[model samples]
Structure formats: structure tokens, C-alpha cells
Target chain A: MSKHSIIISNISKSYGNIKAVDDISLNVKKGELFGLIGSDGAGKTTLLRILTTLLLSDSGNAQIENFDVKNNYKNIRQIVGYMPGRFSLYEDLSVEENLNFFASIFNTTVAQNYDLIKDVYSYIEPFKKRRAGQLSGGMKQKLALSCALIHKPKVLFLDEPTTGVDAVSRKEFWGMLKNLQKKDITIMVSTPYMDEAGLCDRISLMQNGKFMETDTPENIINKFQKQIYSIKSKNKQKLIKDLRKYKQTYSANIFGQAIHYIDKRNNIKIDELKNHLKSENHIDIEIKAVKPNIEDCFIELMKKEQSAVTNQLKN
Target chain B: MIPIIFIMPVVQLVILVYAANLEMKEINIIVINNDYGSLSRQLTDKFSSSPFFNVSFGNSHKEANSLMKKDKADIIMTIPHNFEKKLIKEKSADIQLLFNAVNGTKAAVAAGYCKNIIFNFNKDIIVNSPKLILEPINYKRINIINQFWYNPQLDYKIYMSTGILVILITIVSLFLSSMNLVREKEIGTIEQINVTPIKKFHFIAGKLIPFLIIALFELAFGLIIAKLLFNLPMSGSLLLLFVVAAIYLIAMLGLGLFISTVTETQQQAMFIAFFFYLVFIMMSGIFTPAESMPEWAQKINYINPVAWFMRVIRMILLKGSGFAQIKNEIFILTGYSITVLSLAVWRYRKTG
Candidate 1:
């Protein structure tokens, strides 16, 4: 019924002197499973909180389903379901009691919305008698989502929902979100997992409290302009330093078994890199061109921002 | 197997009942006697003979009352001028006795003891005074029957136990509700709820209602103990007491709710609660009589919901007072209950 389920415009939030969320704007299309991909302190949460109407923006505004986050917050609340980054249900209450209590608050019976949370509910329904405090982390995550979904909101804003969850639970939660999107419920989920970016219809690559770029996961990865290659040697640290000194090298950062280096090396080949590595006191040198993934794009964004900051400081 | 959680309340009850006594056996009283006549001497001798009475005043009852205000004397006894001539002439005489009634029960006991001595001394003189000189005199004897409405024997333990138990239940339950939510903020579960379509009022009411029911169970437990173990009479309507308790509990729970919303840590909320708890319990008339407190202290009682509740519980449970009898107290407590609850609801976190 709406073109954009959520619209954020020039939103800014400052915690003391630090701008947690700088002036940023984004639109979530109808039924789009959007992802806020950022590391810690990238202001992913501040953005989610602003869109969810939990924290007010210092300037600018956001809307969920034609409801202004500031002016029509009550209506926005009814339309949107927010699963905060934390497990916030009543831990002292039994699982069933917590569900019942939340259902009561919305003036709806649990029976009425059983279908909405049925998927998540089934995993935890057997443990309904268990005190929420005693539940394992995955179970708590599921229960928190079930409670949030009890009202069947139109827009779902999850602030890093899968941050601490196990791999299996994280996979299952995203699977559930995929199904929920079929119902045309716009889902906005935030996560630090670079691998999770592929699961979203669109992903925003962010670093240092700003969005580096926003596009389909494939397009963003496609536009990684530089060729990336991994070169590992006995002295990998020394290899990384030698690679950075190359004038044609665009970026170089150590990644697990090797250094993920991107370069504008026009005529240079892998053999040339290996020969140069050996000449620079490196041993057991191996270089292989590797596909650039989301992490590579994230590092590139961070480097671009860092160089810009350094350049401005010099000026 | 023994239940460990039940032990908490039971142990608290024991510690509270023993420490809640307001009675002071070592009361300091100052006497300023200017009249050295036979009457004054007899009056002094009579007071000095009683264990409850003591003479410590330097000047007069006025000075003693001032000293009492400044925590000097607990009580003061004054002797008027020419007290022997008035007694010999067979005329009724009076001596002023000033009491520091801030600590009601103690003050009431000391004042009554002093009055009894004066009355007895008067009767002795009226009977022994010259019969020939007086034209056939007959003296009247007065009888006083003291009755306690809810707690008839004036037992401090039962009175304090019932009132304090109610307070403990409401406070514990309310604190649990508040802390439950605050813990989420600490642990990060609240973010899930914040993004949900759940209404703000629903969240607050949902959190509050469970604790309210728990507090009700405790209230019933307290009333049962008051009726059976303590043998406190339930003369008025049980339904009335039940309704009144419910109303007063709303105020108590509201206080806890407000505390939870204003504070971040469970410890901070508890500290704020305990601070108010100290003031309310002391001024609630459980250990002291509201009637005997100073004008300013009495003014505070008007706003204190517990003070009003003690009167209702005693009237309904002890005196069996009807609506017409306790209508004023019921209205006041109900108002306090509603105001506190509304304030709690208003302050509850709606956006965050």
C-alpha cells in the first residue's frame, strides 16, 4: 500500500560532543528486507533507534507508514515492531507469562496473533513454563522476536538482532525474515556480520558514523574497482609493509592467511609480486587473486574515509 | 525439601517486628515546681514515687515543652501558686502537665499516668478533709475504660506487624516490577520491545498487573495472620478492609513504579524507595498516635496514604466502623492512591 515503508531524512544524533549519527538519509521500499551493515560505533543502532522512534533525532525526521516518527510516534509504534539490540523481556516471568503480558498490553490476545509468531513460538512454546532468565541465548533471541512479532507490525526494525546469537539461530532468524517478507512486511535488520549483507535486498556499507554506499549487495561488490589479491609469506607482516610501498597498490590489509591487497598494477603479474616479495627478504611467498567480498568493500570504505579525514586535517 | 525464597519474607518479618517498637522506658522529664506547700509537696511525692514519671525540668512546663521541641524533656509537670489553700477550701484545682506527643504512644502513657496521680490525690484529700467544717459533702468517683479500635489492648507488636507487613509486601512487589524492566535496559532486551508495535500503556500495565496480583496475595496473608495469630478483631466489614487495602496498595505500587521510571539502576530505585519508606512508616501512626503528633507533623499525615490506611484498617477490623464513620479516611486514601498511580503511569518510559 506504500512505496516506502520507512523514510529517514537527514537524521542526526549527537551523544555529547560526538555525533553518533551524522546527517544521513535512506528509504526502505515496501516489503524490502533492508540491512544496516556496520561495525561497532558506526551508528547503526542510533539510526535504528531514530527510525523506530525510541530516540529522537537532533535534527531532521523519519516516517514509518506515513506516520512521522516524532509527531505521530504513537501511530508509528502501532505500525512498526522494533526488536532492540538487547534481550529485554521480563526474565523473571515464565515464557508464557511474558507472552501473555505483552499480548495484554497491545489489547490483543495471544490466541488472536498465534499465526503471526507461530514459527518462533513453536521453538519456545514447549518451554513456556520456563523462567525466561533460565533460557539459553538462542531461545531468548527467539522469544524476544516472538514477543516483538506478537502484534504483527507492518515494519520490523531489528537493531543488530543476530550479533551474539549462534550461527544456526542466526541462519534460522534470517530464514524466518525471508518468509515474513513474502507477506509484504518491510524488514530492516542491522548486523555486523559481513556475510549477512547478501541476505538483504539492499545493504548500506557504513563506517565511522556515516554510510559509505547503499546498493544491492551484488552491485556494491561489483563496483569494487580495484583488483584484490592475497599474498602470504613466512614474514607476512614484512610482506604487508613491502606491498604498501608499491606506488600502484590501492590498499593492503592482512586477512587471515594472507594480505588482501588491491592494486592498479597494469602490467604486473602475480610472479612479479612474488619476485618482489623474495627480493624484500620475504620467504615462502605466494600470491593469488581473490574475489572481493563484503569485508573488502567495508575496509575500502574505512580507508577512503580515514584518508579523507587525514587530508582535511592537513589542509 | 525447604523452599529458600519463602524464608526471605519470614525472616524480614521477624527482624522488623522486634525493631519497630517506639516505646521509651527511659523518658527524661523536667519538673519546675515553685509552690512548696503541702499540696505541691504531696504532688511531687506522688509523681516521684511512680516508675514511669521522672523530674528533670530546670524552670517550668513551658520551658520543658520548649526543651522537648529541642529534644530536651519527654514530659513536664507544673505546680501552680497556692495549691494547698485551694485544696483545704475544698475547691477543685488543676495542675498543668505538658507532654511531647511526637512519639505518641509513649507520650500518651506518660500523660495518663500523671493525670491518674492528680485525680487520686484529689480524691484522697476530698475524703480526708474536715467533715465538720464542710456542710455535708459527697465526692464523685470517675471510671475510665480505655479501648483500642483494631488493636484493643494497644499491643505494639500486632499493630506494627500488620501495618509493616502490608508495606513490605507492596514495596517488594513494586520493586520487582520496576527492576524487571530496568534489568532489560542493563542487559539490552528493551530494544526488542521498543521496536515492537506494543503500546506504551500496554507495556506499563502488563508489567504492573502481575506484581499487583502478587501484592494482593501478600495482603491476604497479612490479614489472615492479623486475624488468627495476633487475634486482631475484624469488627467492620471484611469487604471494606479488602477494598481499602487494594486502594492503598495502588499508591504504594505507584510509588515504586515512579521510582523505577526516574532511576536507572535497581540499587538507585531501592535507595529512593527506602528513603521514603522510612518517612512513611514512622509517620504512619502504626507506632504513634496521629492525634497526639504536633500540628506540622499532623499536616504531613494528611498527605501520607499509610496514615489514612491505618485508620481505615483499625476502624473496619477493630472498631467495626461503617461508611458513615470512615467516609473521610476512605476518600482521602482513594485520592492518594489514584494520584500516585496516575503519576506512575505518566512517568513510565513511553519512547525509550
Candidate 2:
């Protein structure tokens, strides 16, 4: 039977009085590609830290590959690889030197684990002589991945691995992650880019140290409980405010090229909404029912949480 | 078998034990003897026989003074005229003693030696020529008393080693702390490390081991240099010195780790480490005695790990003091090492 690569139960961590990860719980199956999707500071890094055995929770506990995170961290560290949110590498060491150093730290040599990092390392091989501090964003990211995977860890944790990289580089990185997944390396990646969520086997949408939902990306999109419509007008600024005043409007937020609004008047037709907006001093009105994706799911989840808090306060 | 971890430390202890004690082996002295008589020759013999000083005869007082200012000489003695005639006429005489004040303690000792010779000379002259003092011309004179404490002469090498060791360790600790974290950052391997099956302590220890080796070597080199140049005595047990140094490194590395946790940029980490290094070095009592500090400043020494380490190293090296003599400093260092390390790990967990 395959071992559960990572398991966390009600793990909690705080800095002073602020709860960075509040009673969060989840599991990453032996070979699943798990993702924690959220905006920045959504407790993604905190949760990853605990699971990786680099952090001990204030309460609760976790185990990686059947080893207790607190007691068996050494064993866990040997088997897992982590790429933190920020680029942390020896600025003075050359690219090849860094790889050798980390590989040696794990009691392995680069030649032994050469196959694991061969793909990534090949891309940065031309720049191996360059000091790590001098590498470009994309090249540095590749070299960092090469070092992290040099030990051939059973599981990999990448925290916002694509942040600040160019679009082409982002696409290339995701492609590399896909190939690594084929190696049966259990991967947990955190990213602010919601579009990447669909590429994962499962995702947990997080906000303010809480997980709004945890499920497959397709399921999250399918289970979005609101009918979302995109509306655009000549005066977008005023159009958003006017749409909020409507008694039937449940939620309104700006998304891409339109003001996405969910309405309580589910029976109303699209043409009627357009004509109503035109009558209300909104020009060049266009309205359409758009298919909700992961982004739509996130907005709906946040609105629900906020309304719940407001109602509790009133009570 | 002695553990490899401790081999370097043992070597360091032996080197530093001899390195950190100074007993002023050679004092530079010049003779300005205007008394060209048998008495002048006798006085020069006394100085030449004493291994404590190297005498340069027939030099002018002003020339000798200039050598002292240039750091070439440490003492100058001027004998006034009427040297042999003073004894014949039974008149009082005085010899002028001058010393370099760069180290007030060493200067004071040289002056005390001059006083003792004069005192013994007066006694000898009176005993041999009893009738010469019948008029009771026990002519008024002066006496000066002085004492030197544990390293009483303010040995320069001893003074310098203690201070230099603190600075060296600070640099070592800072380097180690940043190295452990920044390695992951640079390799793009932090993400992989964060996913590792190994525990955090294992990861932290694995990173620290190599730097610890390098630092222990640095400590050894400093000690060896001190011993070869200054034949200072080795007073403390090797076991005790290593134990104290181990504890002190913990505190230093903890501080370095704490700095790494708060800084995103390695450049920023270096600046923060430098600031703390400067603060600890300035307060460690390597250059000045803690007894001379104000009460508030003295109280602060309780918290400064560098000061405690300096105290422990000097006490062990100079006084050859055992753990019993330095128990308070040992306890303080032990507490600091534990507290700082735990706090650093906690902060790292919070920020990681």
C-alpha cells in the first residue's frame, strides 16, 4: 500500500497574537498534485511550513510519510523537498556549487540524483558559472528547482514558485511541474494565480488564515452556488455603484473586463437587465451570463463568509 | 575516541590558554646617567642583571622620552649629578623615573620597581656609613606602594586576545546563521526543502555543522598566534574552555539565525548582523574591565553574551580558574545559549 506522503490535523501557528494558520487541516495523498490557492498572506506559506516539518504548530500536529512532524522531522526532511516563497540560496556560491552543496547535505551527490533534476538543470547549465545573485528571475528559478529536486525527494513543496516570473516563464514552470508529477512525487504548490488552480488535482481556496473551500478545481467551479453575469457600461465606476443599490443584487465585484454581479432576481432575463441599466444613466450597456470559473467561486465564497459574519454581529 | 567535533576545540583551548595571559616579559629602559662615577656603574649592573628590563645606557632623557612616544621604549631613568659625591658629603639625592602611559598599569609597575631600588639603596648606604648620619640627616624621602592583580601588568596580548576572540566568534556566528537559510533561498531548493521528509532540527543541524568546523579552526589559529609571540601561561583546563566556547557559539549562531529570519535580502541580513556584532563587541569588556563600568552598564553585561564569553575565556586563560571560579559566567552563558537558540527556532518557524 502506498504511504500517505503528508497528513496535517488541525494544525495551528501564530506570530505573537496574530494567528497565521488557524486550525487548518488537510492531507496530500502519496502522489497527488495538491495546491493551496489564495491571495497573498492567506496562510498558504504557514500551512506548508507545518507540513514540511520546518515549523511546529502552537497546537495540533502533523505527520509526513507516517513520521511525526515534531518528532521525526529529520526523517521527513530527508524525503521531502521544499522551495520556499522567497528565493533563498547562497548568493556567493556558483549555481553548480549550490546544487552540490544541497545534494551533499542530504548525503547524496549530484551524480546520484542527476536524473531527477536533469530537465531543469539543463536549462541553466549555460549559466552554471554565474553567481546565483547575478542570475535573471527565470534562470534563478530554474536553478533553485534543480537544487531542491537534486535529492530526489518523495514529495515537493513549492511556495508561490511562479510569482514575479514572466508569463512565458510561468507557462514553462507549470510544464516542468507537470513532468515532475509523472514521477509520482507528491507535490503541494501555493500560488496567487487562480488560473493555475485548474491544473491541480485538488485546491484549497484560502483567505485570512482560513480555507474557504477544499476540493477539485472543476468541482469548485461546478459547485459555485450563484449565477454569475458580466455587465459592462460606458461609466463602469458609476455602473458598479448603481448595480449595488438594486435590491435584487446579492454581490458585485470587478472581474477582468466587466463588473460581475450575482442577483437574487434569478428569474430576470439578460435583455431586461441591459435595458434597465440603459434607463439608469448607464450607456453602451452589454450584459451576458458568463460561466463561473475558480475566480467566480472565490468571490462567492468570500461574500458568503463576510455576510455570515455581518449577520452574526447583528444577532 | 575524542569526537571530531571536539578535536578542533581542544587545540583551540591549548593555544588560547597560553595566548590569553600576559606578564610583561620585556620592558624597554634607557639610562641617562650623568653621575659618571662608580655608583653609576653599579646602578647599570643592577638593571642589566634583571631579566625584567633591557637597558640602553648613556642615552639623553629627551631622546629616551622620544623612543617611548614612538612605542620603542617603555621606561626611562634619569640620574642627577653628584652621584658619588652625594655619598661623600652625605646629601640627599633623587632619581627621576618616566614611563609610557598607553597602559597605565604597566607604567605604574615600572615606577614601583624604581622606588624599591631607591629605598634599598638608602638603607644600604645608612647601614654601611652609620657615623655619616650621626647628625640624624635621615633626610626626608618618599615611598610608593603598588600591587598588580590577576594579569596585573595589563599584558597587551592577553588584553587583545580576549577582545579579538569575541569579534571573531561574532563574525563566525553571523556567517553561519545566514549561510543556513540563504543556501536554500539561492538554490531555489527552499520549496523542495520545505516539502522534505526530514525534521527541522535535522535540517538546521545539518546546515550548522560545516560552519561550526570552520569557526573552531579560526579560534585555533588565533590562539596559536598568541602563544608563539607571547609566552603567556596556560591556566585553564582544555575541557572547560571548550565547554564554554561551545555554549558561547550557540548564543552567537542563535542571534545570527534570528537576524536571518527577519530579513528578506541577504544584504539586509549582513547589515543587521554587523549592527549586533558591533554592539556586543563594544560591551564585552575586552578593552575595558567590567568593574570600571557604571552600575547600569554592569547590569547590562548580564545579558550581553559576548561580555560573558570574554569573562569566561579570560578567567580560564589567565587565572587558570576552574568551573567553580567562573560558575556564574558559565551559568549565564548556558542560559543565553539555550534561550537564544529556542527563540531563533521559534521565530524561524513563525516566519518560514
Candidate 3:
């Protein structure tokens, strides 16, 4: 068996003239939980679809468990389980029926792999007789996970499983995934939420069908070269406009009630930035340099990407 | 889906049995009585009282002929002048019955009704006057014998029930099979299934087997009810009928699968299936005889599986046709099954 469970090279997929997945490539190691973190339409779903053998990439090759995506698709299908972004299990069927159906299609029974899905199954077992379409969002996710894991697959692909789920369920869902990783299943998940990126072993931050950066969540945060400041004022709306007028300010974006901005001149003192806002009729302003998170890194990288495109167009 | 499977057959059987009546009644007759004798008046009263004929007196024979030509009158009875005198002296009278044969089936039925009325009138004359029996010249000596075989009663309900059973089986199997597949696509479940190691043949069989069983079950259930309700005769072997139905369903199911392959949504599949269903039903010779249709339409029946099944079902149920008699229909249906199933399998793609 190969050490790497998934390998995608030079994959490009286009829908009409819009490049949904443009010249992207990546790999997932065996037993590694990799995250493809991006907002909607960043080609996260498209890339996952290609690796799962549901779609053929426009260019280049993708392999799952050393099997070619195009030729060895049948082999690939045997070892991989995919939970699509949509709630796609048979709605007319009961919870247990849906589980049994997926299990039987893989030529196994739910009893055979009860232990593999017991964690998620416990939440849904009481509603075993209830129709799948009638379940709550959190319960549906649990059911989907249980069905996907029923076959004890070598790899699992989950696309935006936590998008519409509640915060508690989302956290609990990630906890379940971490538990599954101990069994040596290479899990590749995609999400539009930047907060979820920190839960993965490693993540590739994507934008507009291209990988902006790929690294451990902590490492990517460490590589944020620009210093981000958590600035608060009595009036955040006016402060944003005033802060953007500062010559040293590189970017000023709203984050919750406070504003996070990067400085062009690294050596600028806090007092100097404070006085600038104070001069703009801003009172009781607090500015402190803070550690950047993935969302800040994403915004900074997107800016850099856009500027690069503009430069190329200028040339 | 299960409720529909149970309900559709009964509802369709009731509607189809009642609506498919081809029996013509109340044929309008124009009587041109030139003789104002009591005998002519009595004959005219007999024609008017009969349920089959609606009688009206015409001003002249020419007017009655024109009325028949214009389709206003189905029949014209022109009683010649001095008809009573001739019958009394010459022992024979000439009365002409002209029929509009444009609609040949209706015309034939109307003519039969008129003949029965005239025959009854002849019996009355013979009974009233015993002297006429000695000559035996009052009536024409043309002896005509009528024998109706198979469905002797000409019960349209019996024919319609069997025909409708075939249609129900075809439609239910086709719609359910195709709609099942398209629903999977619509709900994105197909993507989940396609990514599995399941072979294409296994996938298609999985889709086909359930609906095939349900459709066949419906056919048996419907046939049993029809037999009980209408006393529908099964002249040929039940095993042979089922064997042919199984083959016929495969063709319809294949058409369904083919439609699913080309359509991405259930609505699209429905519309396309409906289009083909309309063409098949109209040309299946269920309401009209295939022989009465044009030559080109008869040629179209060569490719129509429903038409083949319709004819075969009627033959087996009504005419008691055996396997040898219907071998050609079975062969054609088998050919249709192979072509459609092969096309469906080829068109179903594992990947986009």
C-alpha cells in the first residue's frame, strides 16, 4: 500500500468559461485529516468530486489509493466513501433503512461494522424508525456520517457537512472525525468556514480555484508577515474610514465589533496610530497588535492574489 | 408510490371500461311514405317505436336521399306509391332502404337494426294473413345467417379491460422505473451510488427488478379484478400471457431507462415518456381496428411494441390464439426489448 492515500496533479475543471477548479494539485497522506478550506465556489467541492472519481478533471491525473481516477475508478470506488454537500440519502426510507441500504450496496451489513459507526449511530439509533427526511439538521449529519462510515472504507470524503449545522453539532461532528482518524482512514473534508480549518491536521486555503497557501494551521498563521491590530472605537464605522486614510494602513476590515487592519510600516508605534485616530474626533480608541488567525491570513492572501492578477494585466 | 400502484389500476379500469363503447344506437331514419294507406302508417309507427331507430316523415323521396347524403339521416325508407295495391294484387311490394355508408361501422350497425325491424314487420303480415303463406312471395328468398364468434355478445367492456390492463402495466413500469432513476439524480443520490464499486449492470438490475415485480403484480391483480367484474374470458394459456407480458415489460422498462439516461430531472423524463406513450396508445389499435388504419400507420405498427402487445393480448384473451398463432408478435417484442435495453445500457455513463 502506498503511504499517500490521495494524489492529484495539475487538475483543471471548467464550467463553461468559468474555471471552477483551475490548475490545482495536492495530496493526502494515509491516516491524515486534510482540509480544503475555502468559501463557496472556491472549487472545494469540484476537487473533492474529482478525487472521489465522481467527476473527470479537465486536465492532469488524480489517484486514490494508487488507483488511477480515470481507469481504476471501479477500484477507487470500492475503498472510498463520500458524503456529498447535500442531504442525499433516501428521504422516504427510515434512518436504519438508509444505513442498511448503503451498507448492503457495499455488500456488508450494519451489524458487521457496528463498532465503526457506533459513535455517530448512538445519536440516531433512537430515531431508527423515523424517516430520514424528518430528522433535524444535526441528526441528519450524524446519519450521513454513519452511512458513509458503515462500509469501513479506506478513505472518507465529506463536503461541507457542517455548513447548516448548529455550533454545538459542528463542534461535536469535528470531535467524531478526530476519533475516526485513529483507525487510519485518510479523511479529506472541505468547508467554507475558516474556524473549522484549525481542526484539521493540515489545510490548504483556497481562493478562486487556486490554493493560496497550504500548511499546518499554526504554521500558516505564523507565516502572516503583516502585523494585524485589533482596533476598537466608540464608533467602528467612522473608525474604519478614518483608519483607511492613514498612509501606513495596508488594509482595514471589520471583524465582529472591532476592526482588524494591517500596517504597511512595521516599525510604526502604537501611540502614532492612536493619535491619528484621535485626531479624527475618535475618543477612547484602543489599539493592540494581536496574533493573526486563518481568516486574517485568508483576507491578506486574497489581497495579494488580486494585486498579482492586476500586475499581470498591467504587463 | 405504493398507494398509486394500488389505486391506479382500479381507477383506470373503471374509466376505460365505461368510456370505450363503440356500439352505435338511435340511428335516425327518414320515411318517405308515398302511399297514404293504413298499412304504410302501421309500418311507420313500428319503425318509430323501436329503440334503435328514430323515425321522421320526409316530404319527398329526393329530400330523404339528400338527408342521408348530408349525414342528418342514417337511413332512408322510401315506400313506393300503390304499395298496398301491389302487395294485395301482385303478392309483392318494393320498399327501398338506403344507408349512408361513409362511417362504415356505424352504417353496418344501422343497416342491421333496419333489417330486424323489417323482418318483424314481415312476421306480423304473415301471422295476420294466413293466405299470404301459401304464395311465399311477400318476402325476398335471400336467406342470411349471422354467427358471431369469440365475443359473441360483442361486449366492449371485455375487450377494453384486457387492452387497458396492458396499457396500465406498460405505463406503471415505464414511469416508475424512469422516475425512480431521475429522482435519484435530482436528489443527488445517484452521485453517491455511482461512486460505489457496484457494476453498471448490477445498478441497472437493481433499478429494474423492483419496478418489474410491482408492475407484474399489478397486472395479475388487475387481470383478476377484470375477470371477476366483466367475466373477461381467458381463452389461451395464462402462462403464455404472462410470459409475453414479462417480455413486453422489459421493452417498456428499457424505454424508461433510456429516457432516464437522457433526462436529468423527473419532470423531463415524465414529459418525454408521455410523448412516446401518447404515440404508442393512439396507434396501438385499442380504440380502432388496425386494418381500418392507413397503410403508413399499419407500417408504423411494426415498430410499436404496445401495438404488438395489444394485438397479442386480444388474440390470447378473446380469440384463444396459441403460441404458434402469436409467434410473430412475441418475436417482434423480443426484438424491441433487445434494442431498447441495449441502448439504455450504452447511454448510461459511469462518469460525467
Candidate 4:
């Protein structure tokens, strides 16, 4: 068996003139929890569909657990379980019936793989008699996870599984994933929420059909390469506008109630920034150096990629 | 859904059988009397006494023509002046008959009825007139007695019911099967199924078998109604009918699967299916004879599955034909089923 559960090399897919998945490649080791973090239209779903053998890439190739996605798609289909972004279960069928149906299609019974999905399945077992369409959004997510895990697949592909789920349900869903990884099943999940990036062992920050960075969340943040300051004032909207107008501002964006600002130079003087904001009729100005998170690192990488493209165009 | 499947066929069968009548009756005729002679009055009374004609009197030929122009009359018969004198002196008299030819079939039938009435009146005159009896050297008369085969009464409902039953089966199986796969596409469940390890043949069979059984059940239900309400005959073996129906349904269901594969939505599938249904039903000879169509249309009916079954079912049920009688149609249907099903399977794709 190969050490890597998934090996994608220079896979490219295009829809007419628009490239949905540009030439992209990555490797996910067995038993590792990998995340593809990006906003909508970043080609995350397209890449996952290629790896699951549901779609063909226009160029390059991909493999799931050493089975070629092109020639050995049958073998790949037998080993991988996919949950699409939409609720695709038989809505008229009950929860237990839906799970049983998926399990039977995979040539296994629910009792055969009961232990694999016990943690997730147990959460919705009490409401198993209710129709799938009648279940709450969070309950539906749990049932979907149970169905995906019912066959004890070697690799599970979840495409935005928690997108419309509630916050508490999203957290619980992630917790369920952590448990599944302990059983040696390689998990590849995609989400638009940056806060969920920390849960994965490794993640690829994607934009415009290409990956900007692929590394551990902590390492990506460590490579921010500049000091980021969080500044708060009485007028947050005015503070953001004033910070963008400053000559030394590298980038100014609103993060919650404060503005995360970066400077053009290596070191920035906090009193100088406070005095600049005060001059603009700001009050209760507070500026402090704060450690960068995944969102901060993502913004910085995206900005760098944008500048690189413009420079290439000029050349 | 189950109730609708069972109820719709019965409703369509009853309503269509009762409403679609091909037999023509009650032709309206206008008679213009130019002579007040006894012979002319006798001819006018002969037309009014028959069950087929609704008779009305007119003063002049112009009045009858105007009535026909207003669509108030179907045929106009004008008796000429000196009608009795010409018949007595010259041994012949002219009676002019004009017909409204807007509906060609109705006009032709009405003209035939008029000819029969006139022929009978001539026979009465020859037998009753002492002068004609003495003068005639001989009269050789031949009459034809019609014995309608299979349907002695020539009830239009019996013929229409069988054709409607074939159509009912076609609609249920073809429309349902065509919409089945496209529905999954609409609901986004096809993507989930495509990722599974299920084989294409298995998937296609799973979709076909259930509808095939339901269609067969519908056929049985429609047959019961036909027998009870229309007194339709079932002279052929029920088993043979079902076997042939199974083969015919495979062809129809295959066509539907082909439509489903080509279309992306239920609405699109419905439109395409309806187009085929219209062409198939019209060309199937259900409402009209396939043999009487233009030569090119007759050639097109060779590829029409419904046309094949329509001819076969009538032969078996009405004519009590055996396997040897309908073997040619069965062979064609078997080949059609294989070709259409293979095409559908070939067109189905698991991955883009």
C-alpha cells in the first residue's frame, strides 16, 4: 500500500474559458486530517470531485489510495465515501432507512460497520424514524456524516458538510471528525470558515483555482513576515477609513470590533498611530501588537499573490 | 402516487372510449318539391320515413341552396317539373342531388345513404306499375348481405377501448421512466449515487423493473374495465398478451431511459417525451388505419413500437390470433427492445 492516501499531480479542470481547477497538486498521507480552506468559487469542490472519481480533470491525474481516478475509478469508488455540499439523501425516507440504503449500496450492512459510525449515528438515533427532509439542519448534518461513515471507507470526502449548520453543531461535527481520524481513516474536508482551519493537521489556503499556501496552520501564521496590530477606537467605521488613509498602512481590514492593520515599514510606533487616529477625531484609541491568526495569514498571502500577478502582467 | 397510477388509467379509458365515436348517424337533408304530383310526394315521404335522415321541406331550389350555405342542411334533393309525365312517356326522370362536402367522410356516407333510398324507391316503382311489369322482358336483381366479422355490431367503443389501453400503458411507463432519472438529477441525488460502487447495468435495471411491473398491473386493470364496460373480447391467451406486453414495455422504457440520459431536468424530459408521444400515438394507427396513411408515413410506422403493439393487440384480442399469426410483430418488438435498451445503456455516463 502507498504511504499517501491521496496523490494529485498537476490536475487541471476547465469549464469553457474559465478554469475551475487550475494546475494543482498535493499529497495527503494516510490517517491524516487534511483541510482545503477557501471561500466560495475557489475550486475546492471541483478538486474533491476529481479525487473522488466523480469528475475528470482536463489535464494531469489523481489517485485515491493508489487507485487511479481515471482507469481504476471502480476501485476508488469502492473505497471512498463522499458527502456533497447539498442535502442529497432521499428526503422521503427516514434517517435509518437512508443510512441502511447507503450501507447496502456499498455491499455492507449497517450492523457490520456500526462501531465506525456509533459516535455520530447515536446523536440522531432517537429521531431515526423521522423523515430526512423533516430533520433540523444540525440533525441532518449528523445523519449525513453517519451515512458517509457507515461503510468504513478508507478515505472520506466531505464538501462543505457544515456550511449551513449551526455553530454548536459545526463544533460537534468537527469533534466527530477528530474521532474518525483516530481510527486511521484519511479525511479531506473543505470549509469556507477560516476559524475551522486550526482543527486540521494540515490545510491548503486556496484562491482562484490555485493554492496560495499549504502547511500546518501554526506554520502558515508564523510565516506572516510582518507585525500585525489590532487597533480599537470609539468609531470603528471611521477608524477603518482613517487607518486606510494613513501613509504607513500596508493593509487595513475590519476584524470583529477592531481593525487589523499592518505597516509599510518593519517596525511601527504605536503612539504615532494613536496620534494619527486622534487627529481624525478618534477617542479611546488603543493600539497593541497581536499575534496573527489564519485569517490574517490568508489575507497577507492573498495580497502577495495579487501583487505578483500584476508585476507579471507589467513584465 | 400509487392511487394516481391506478386511477388515471381507468379514468382515461372510460372517458376516451365514451367520447371517441367514429360511426356516423343522423344526416340532415332538405327536399325541394317543384311538382305537386303523387309520385313526387311519395319520394319525399320515403326520405322522411328512414331513421338516418332528418327531413325538412323547401319551396324552391334557391331556398334549399341557401339553407345548405347556412350550414343548416347536409344534402339537397330537387324534384323536377313533369317528373311523372317524363317517367311515363320517356321511361326516365331526373332528380338532382347536391351534397355539402365540407367534412368529406360525412358527406360520402350521407351520399351512400341517399343512393340506397333512391334505389329502393325505383324497385318499388317497377314492382307496383302494371305497365312496367308487362313491358319488362326480365329483371335480374342481386342483393348483398353484410356479415361483419369479429364485431358483429361494429361497435366503435370496442375498437377504441383497445387502442386507448395501449396508449394508457405507454404514457404510464414512458413518462414515468423518463422522469425517474432526471428527478434524481434535479434533486442532486445522482451525484451521490454516481460515487457509489453500483454498476451501470444494475442501476438501469433497478429503475426499469419496478415500472415494468407497475405498467403490467395497469394493463391488467385496464383490461378488466374494458371487458366489463365495453364488453371487449379476450379471445387470445392472457399469458401471451402479458409476455408480448413485457417486450413492448421494455422498448418503451428503454426509450424513456434514453430521454432521461439526454435531458438534465424533469421539465425537459417531459417536453421531449410529449413530442414522442404525440408522434407515436398519431402514427400508431390507434385513431386511423396505418395502411391508409401516405406511403412515407406507413414506412415510418415500421420503427414505431406503439404501432407494432397496436396491430398485434387487436389481432390477438379481436381476431383471436395465435403465436403463428403475430410472430412477425413479436420478432420486431424483441429486436426493437434490444436495440433501444443497448442505446440507452451506451449513452448513460457515470462521469463527465
Against the true structure, whose lDDT is highest?
Answer: 4
TM-score of 4: 0.96
**Cα error of candidate 3 at position B230, Å:** 1.6
* lDDT, residue B168, model 1: 63
Worst 10 residues of 2 chain B by lDDT: B1-10
| Cα TM-score per model | 0.77, 0.62, 0.90, 0.96
Q: Compared with the true structure, what per-residue lDDT tens digits does model 3 show for residues B194-243? A: 87777888888888888888888999989988988899999999899989
lDDT of 4 by residue, B1-352 (tens): 9899878878998998888878766778988878778788878889989998999988877888888899999998889889877887777799999999999988998898889998888877777876553455444656689999999999989899999999999998899999999999999888989999998999999999999999999999999999999999999888899999999999999999999999999999999999999999999999889999999999999999999999989998999999999999999999999999999999989997
The chain A TM-scores for the candidates, taken one by one, are: 0.94, 0.95, 0.98, 0.99
lDDT of 4 at B281: 97
lDDT of 3 at A226: 81
List model 1 lDDT by residue over A131-152, tens digit each: 9999998898888888877778
RMSD of each: 6.7, 9.7, 3.6, 1.9
* Candidate 1 chain A, run of 10 with poorest lDDT: A265-274
The best candidate in terms of DockQ: 4
Q: Tell me how candidate 1 scores on lDDT.
A: 0.78
**Which regions in candidate 2 have their CA more than 4 angstroms from the true location?**
A2-5, A14-19, A58-61, B1-352
In candidate 3 chain B, where is summed lDDT lowest over 10 consecutive residues? Answer: B130-139
lDDT (tens digit, per residue) of candidate 4 on A20-134? 8999999999999999999999999999999888898999998889999999999998889899999888899999999999998998999999999999999999999999999
What TM-score quantifies how close candidate 1 is to the native fold? 0.77
Fraction of true inter-chain Cα contacts (below 8 Å) kept per model?
A: 0.73, 0.56, 0.78, 0.87
Number of clashes in model 2?
37
lDDT of each: 0.78, 0.78, 0.89, 0.92
